[model samples]
Target chain A: MTHTVLVTGVSRHIGARVASVLAADPEIGRVIGVDTAPPPSLSSDGGVPLGRTEFVRVDPRGPDIAKVISAADVDTVVHMSLVSAPPRSGGRALMKEQNVIGTMQLLGACQRSATVRRLVVRSTTAVYGSSPRDPAVFTEDAEPAEPPAHGYAKDACEVEGYVRGFTRRRRDVTVTTLRFANFMGPGVDSPLTRYFTQPVLPTALGFDPRLQFVHEDDAVEVLRRTATEDHPGTFNVAGDGVLLLSQCARRAGLVTVPVPSSAFQLMGELARGAGLVDFSPEQLRLMRHGRVVDTTALAAALGRRPAFSTATAFDDFLRARDIAGGLPAALMDLLTRAVAR
Target chain B: MSDVDRRVAELLALLRRRVTGEYEVDEFGFDPELTDKVLLELVRPLYRDWFRVETTGMEHVPADSGALVVANHSGTIPLDGLMLQVALHDHHPARRALRLLGADLVYRLPLLGHLARKSGHTLACREDADRLLRKGELVGVFPEGFKGVGKPFSERYRLQRFGRGGFVASAIRAQTPIVPCAIVGAEEIYPKIGDLRLLARALGLPYLPVTPLFPWLGPLGAVPLPSKWVIGFGEPVRTDEFDPADADDPMVVFHLTDQIREIIQQQLNELRLRRGHAFPPFF
Candidate 1:
């Protein structure tokens, strides 16, 4: 019983990699990579070529997406319709519209179509939001401290709510929502990576919040497993362990400038104007109070531990970017050598 | 290498581990290496010399198993918790680290929160408490919270009402024993004479304490009074006798909470008499 999989947001790196992975799977009969634009020189972080995945230039916001879903007899719809890169034209507002509306329209199609039974929506841990009052480790069932006021976190929140509603509409669909930690490693560009790679990283003043990172390869593998398998439920997918924001800086060799949180946002706006990094309210909130989610459920469902821990994933990121032996790392190495002798 | 050089190399190696971020913090962010090498080292002097903290019933605290150490919170500055850590780390035969459950305010600050986590302190939330207990780690809690810390000088030794008996429930859930801890000298360290509610509200603190030397002496006054402290650990109150399901039963939780509270109060009374003077004649 081979399956035809329809993957949305195929133009993006993660989406393209997911599509290509499915396309290469022997169990998958056909793979339809649907997005408004074609995938840009697509391949996974592991160099898994985007060879067999068929690209269908279709807007998920329009009815044509439903037509394509029906025509292809797609059995699994991998919905990762997210755009988190720096603002290009209309900024956050347009991205919000694209994310929420695209998700809504795609859900409508999935709910109506008989062929669509499996739904894998790529969500984020950002939905949990950051705060001093929240739990140290959030299990999947834990309620968020408070819904995010605005930014991509809010958008992810709304998108997840839609995903929940989709579950009710189509009871037969095996819905798997993965709230992934910030993805890191080479062959990827994210806000966290951008911030770390910058000559000087600006941090929230007086805070050295604990952080977690999921390697891009691990993320891709988990996405692939969830999409192909029958695991039905929202699971927090993150590498084991945690890192401090300051440790990340020391490892990345970036000088950190501490800005008061009130003034931090203003500094963010200034950086945005200079085309350095776009810092949303949610991101700033994370810098102030970092999030750490429990991945016990994921481990139970997947039947294995992630290959990379948080520390190792960070090390991979530094190595891939050729950022080995940063400030503290180099200094520590020298001290260790002299002492060892 | 000479003996001095060998020791220097060992110290430098530890420094390298810390500087290179080679240390591991538990899931709760308790850096054992840092806690043992740095935090406890800093607090030991105060515990031994300044507080001159004497211990009783060290035999009651389990050698290697998970147990909740419930204590009375005092000292206007809340140094009792640190002293408690030093007591367990230095006095206990196994030198086990106490993973403290802190108030939300401890985590709301900047460097304070970072240090709290590194020292194995977390917000006194039910989930974290239960998690630590399940991991078989010793957890310390000051159930009195701010009320115990902020009480006026007149009401110094009296214990405040425990907050809904959360620590008791956590102990039950973990099916571990609760070691009732009583610290006698903490209440006298900074005799809180007054509280300014307006300033407290403005600063978003629980209470703006006016100690005898605090405002009058400025920064110099912040130093705690050198009192002869006695930390007595009462016998372990076994929660394993009851079913773990009892954690949900409010009546059982209430009963256990009162029992533990009474044990600590009784211990405090006895220890207070034993110490005789806040600034002891022996000192």
Candidate 2:
């Protein structure tokens, strides 16, 4: 297990934790963290400490990462830098460059580095773009019902394509792509987390798409476990079970206003414009047709189940929020009893 | 407490569970609690009173485990599936939930799609059907799809192409028995007299049906006729008798599909004759 690992996206929560955890492993001799900005000190996002990880700032636009990969003699590369949405600071263009081109540079570097034996790329289930034609449950091999056209989904798809190309070029490298479901935890700040935590959720009219979740703790655990070992090929990583958006709103004590699908996207933009939330088109379609992936392949590869199911993960997320509205608990209780009879 | 009090207490406890989100659904988003408590209760009236649906050969439905119920699809609006669901739930000895495989259009709609999934139904794709059968669920399929549903009123009960025999392949792969079911009287519910192609095209619907009272009568015509119904489940056609590899053989799939189609068609004719007029009392 003695290897020099180069971890990308060290600036983000998941990357920082993965780099920190891998650095802590005694068998792993060195960890080189690469990012545009320096690692956040004593990160409060999740309180994960950056342990003995040596940070290296390199411009993602250029071929500088290639130099770092070869010079550090990095044997294992953990590419966790892909962004799901255009960040508030960096808009869509910048986000796309960092996700797509940045991945290309990193994979090209990994391809040239003969020492790099294993590669773990963090992917999203969003690649399986939402549509009415989708199956009830998506297997790893299942194609997206509606192929992504733009935004973060297209970026993720392109990144996966480069990974596939790299796998073909570097046959010796064991590539593992983990397509994760919506990340839900108290510490996580995802598009879905923000959407769910809102006081009033504007759901797509008449659509209660089934959604799955992966807890932040379990997400870090999966990344850490795979970074150390070899789990070749793509796997859909998520907790067992699913939750309807309506059910989620009810459980979280939030009132939902159903907007027609025609107006849902516009409404999302209006909310975004109001500076209430960062609502992207990808997120909008996702809300309209919720995505759920099969996690049996993940369990088989990891040899264990995720710590939290979708329902419990959601409840865990709800515990941290100030649940202030919606129907009173007593009223819900009374109604349920009346309906049960 | 007496028996009445005990039942009341149990209902209250279950209601409390519902409020707390303490129920579970399978990976396919099938909520057994919601399906049994809410959905089944909603459709019970249509089965018991509206259509007065009667059943026969329910013994053929496996008491436990996987079985594929292949039935003829008819009626302009496709309410037969709902009535069939209610019938199986109430009449089956085990009261098993029949997980139907529906057309993509069923899911394309908004509120309708949500309720459909909560009621334990899924897309009519082979993978979903295969997974459901493998899990030992009583999977239901209407192979004729829009073809059977949109057939002319004069040609009602005439079977349509089952579409590549995908259902047969799914059942064979899962090694489940196929229970050929026939539902009479649904064809009379909304008799398709004409199809407005231009209107359907604009609406992006498969077919804009023109029933006697529909279109002319507007919303009033949307109401389904309360026709007498009979659902007969035939003997199970065992797929396990053949090797699972048989699922890959196109000829085997075609033969099985054709055989099931013939059985359901014949069953439909006999059941319709037994029930006499679709709208009358004297049989």
Candidate 3:
């Protein structure tokens, strides 16, 4: 029997990739992609159709999401929808309402629906607040810190709590929460990408914190595994290796300027306040701490190794951006992609 | 001033003198290590601005031995731990360094990994605890874990679950005495105005702790209010006296844990009564 799956936030980036991957699976007969935004234009690149996927333009935060999912007869729900960027002036409040309320509503839907048997919620490594980096790395059980900033993440965590709690009440529903590290690949527009794309990357003065990046493909694979596998509880989904931010930028051929840590912190605060950046002080703290999560649990659960390395991921990103040959290559690719689009 | 008041004042003055001059240079030393700098820079201003820290029970801490100093972990953050370390090293006659048994959360950060290791913090793992104790080090354990440190400001002084007497087990296994220490001021440092657990998890932090002034005021607000800190060490619970084989006995563990909790609670009550303030008084 073909299993129907519901994936939220499937209009863009990670969600879209997840949808495509799931749709390709023989076991997953149909995938209902939920997102607030309009679905991206799906077309054949190199005479190969991506896959068959259905787009549902409905706000996951709305009460109607459950109805929509129930109508679709989704057997599994992969909650990938979230406001990934830093909250705006009122973003935190919006995020809380959307993420927390949306999750509750979704959980309610799952409870009411007989078809929905398993749920996988996409979480971030941001849940683990900044700590002193350990060489041994953080396992799934690593307790979170009270982050000084990033209020939205806290709300998201509450959603996870509700989901986990819901599982205990209903023995039938199996839930898995994946706390992913910094993910980079095609279609990602994070601060790391911004730094790489910029002519001059701004770095904290006197500090080059270690960073972990999971390629988009690897991220999708982990998500795919989570959606299909029977693993329960939370796991830290990270890449195989670690790299410094400066190293990433240098490898990408981006120039870097050492900005005072205080200045950068101030800028970050201002950006968060202005809704220009999504990272909280706590997120910055983790970034400063250079998180290296232990991927043992994730690996054990997935039963496979992640495909991309930090070097290879960076190389792939450069190739995708057409910046492999350096400055000229980056400019040409940018112009060409712009023209093509 | 009365004689007792004069003596207490003189002792405080003498301790301050020792801390600033001989003690700081000799014991902890004016090392340019970041943790020391972080402790000095972050704490000193608050000390000058808001706190008049007084530390007692310096003698209970083993001068040179692998002793497990188990204390009730409170305060929004472990500001008490930082202060206690500073106070113990600077005030104690032996100037023993405290190797804190931090939670798994402390050892999870990237750059903080080195800092925590360098600052002598290990995972609250029994193996780590055993290793540190066997090495003749003073190990500090806050059995309360996150439950204690993340307590709401309203229930600030109230102790939380100490995790089934693991500290006692560790102490017994290592044959070290468990010192019950009470910190008076930490609860007020960053009186948790609110906690957002989901946000905490997203940032991969323990709790999304909001001080009354942080985030809104940025770094300036991050400055902890100098609440006059009083650290008191109670009599040690001798682990050597207990049968090591009885480590797995629930009754034995429960009694020890209860006894430790009572001692800490009593000290907290005493300090509160003596201080005569709803919150610790800033200078």
Candidate 4:
């Protein structure tokens, strides 16, 4: 039976890719892509092709979202609009409103729909707040020792709670929550990516936390798998290994200035307020004590393994960043010469 | 080239490799080369010249495959674990790297925690232990934990209760051997005469030990006493003989745990008998 898949947040890269891949599949009958704004169409960085797609301009938070879902008779709902960063200059509050209210409204729509069989929600590992008391690795069953205090992580935790409630009410729907680790790739833009772009990364003094990353391709593939396959329940999606914050900075060729924790937090706040970067308190907590998620369930239950390990993902990110930044080869040669002298 | 130039060149090369993402780091973020260059080099003097650790029954350590080295914990600073790592890494026939299971406090400390991870020390939990052993890595466990490390000078070398025999269950689950190990002289390194409980609570330390030198002598006094050390390994007690389901049996776990603890206590006693002085001026 061909599935009528309705993908939310088509304007976003991963969501667009998910839509594009599903639309191309022979098994999928029709794809319905929905977003508030039309996706970018520039050839160089154009959105992924939504082949045989019926584009619907509808806000997930609005009542119109229900009409779109009901009219399409969608069998699958892939909720991808849960924003990790401020999509535009809307600031954090707007993003939170979009995430929480949007998820609530969309789930309501899915519940109302009789045809919806599968629900794939894109959650994040940030739900597992970084704390000194946290276990070395968090399995799917492990509760967040300290709930995320603020920002996207908080929103994610709330979103998962809503998803759980939805699963109980609509027991027929297969709910797969993919809590992705800090994702990075050639084209991926995230808070971590922005943090690395800085010339001098200010690290917390005396603290070097272990970090994990999933390659953009791996993340997209995992998202695709949940949407396409029959895997149910929560899965912590991440690449195989971990990297140190210091190691990440070193690999990026950025000079690290170890600032005291209080001072570092103050600087981070200033940076975030100035819109110089996206530095949330949750990110600071992450830097203080890194969180690792166990992906044994992803392999065992989901029957999928990421192609790139954490270290390799980080390496690729650095390589892509260098090429993207257009760091001159001559500058490296000049630095080498000066150092030799 | 001069020794300084060669050393600098080697360091520079290592830095380049690290920066260029050539050097491999393991799943736990363990950089073997970096740990060797930095941590091993720093601990070499203390292991070789200072503590002067003498090892025996190292043949008990399997040439390959996973083995859990259950040892007694001592020393106010808990330097015994690091020294044990050095011993196995340097002395074992296969030069096996000991993946020590450290206390939570070790990972709570800032700079120290990062180094511990890079040096292949993970949180002393069964999940990590089970995984490491299954991967065929030799693991070290100090079951006595803080009770052993923070015990008073008068109670030095006295074994503490091994918490619930979690490590034994892990060994059984992994179907690996438990190599009982004991290290004497660590207890004398920083004899904990008293514990500043109030200060420790305020500072978030397990215990603020008041040694003869520490606080009184300041930072200089923090240097460990160069006591003669002996690390004795016992024959590997095979856990493979038992059914895997027996790991859940508390009776079996407790019995095996006591057996290993007794072996370590016996080794410590033997080493103590041969020791001449606490801090002999010359070896």
Best by lDDT: 2
The lDDT ranking, best first, is 2, 1, 4, 3
Instruction: Provide the lowest-lDDT 10-residue window in model 3 chain B.
Output: B21-30
lDDT of 2 by residue, B30-134 (tens): 888888888888878878888988899999999899999999999988888888888788888899888999988878898888788888999988779988998
**Which portions of model 2 show Cα errors greater than 4 Å?**
A43-47, A322-327, A330-341, B2-11
Candidate 4: tens digits of C-alpha lDDT, residues A1-341 = 54799889887777887888888888888899988788777465745777777888887778888998898798998988888877657788889888999999999999999999999999999999987656667888877668898999999999999999999999999999999999888777778888888888899988888899999899888877788878889999999988888777766666789998899999989988888878889999999888888999989986668999988898798887773322333355455556556
lDDT on C-alpha atoms for all candidate structures: 0.85, 0.86, 0.71, 0.85
DockQ preference between candidates 1 and 4, better one: 1
Docking class of 1: medium
DockQ-based CAPRI category assigned to the predicted complex of candidate 3 = incorrect
Q: lDDT of candidate 2?
A: 0.86
Cα lDDT tens digits, model 4, B158-269, are 8999999999999999999999998898999998898899999999988999998988999988999888998989999999999989999999999999998888888888
- Give per-residue CA lDDT, model 2, range A239-309, as digits (tens): 88888877788788678899899898898899877767777887888887788888888898889999999
Worst 10 residues of 3 chain A by lDDT: A41-50
Better of 2 and 4 by DockQ: 2
Residue-by-residue lDDT tens digits, candidate 3, A273-298: 76555546655665455555767787
Note the B-chain TM-score for every model: 0.97, 0.95, 0.81, 0.94
Worst 10 residues of 1 chain B by lDDT: B19-28
Write one digit per residue (lDDT tens) for candidate 1, span B1-283.
7998889888887876766677777666678888888888888888888988999999999998999999999888889999989889888999988989998898899778878988988888998899889988899999989989888878877889998999999999899999999998998889998888999999999998888898899998888889889999999999999998999999999999998888888898999998898986755
- What tens-digit string does per-residue lDDT give for candidate 1 at A73-94? 9889888877764346778777
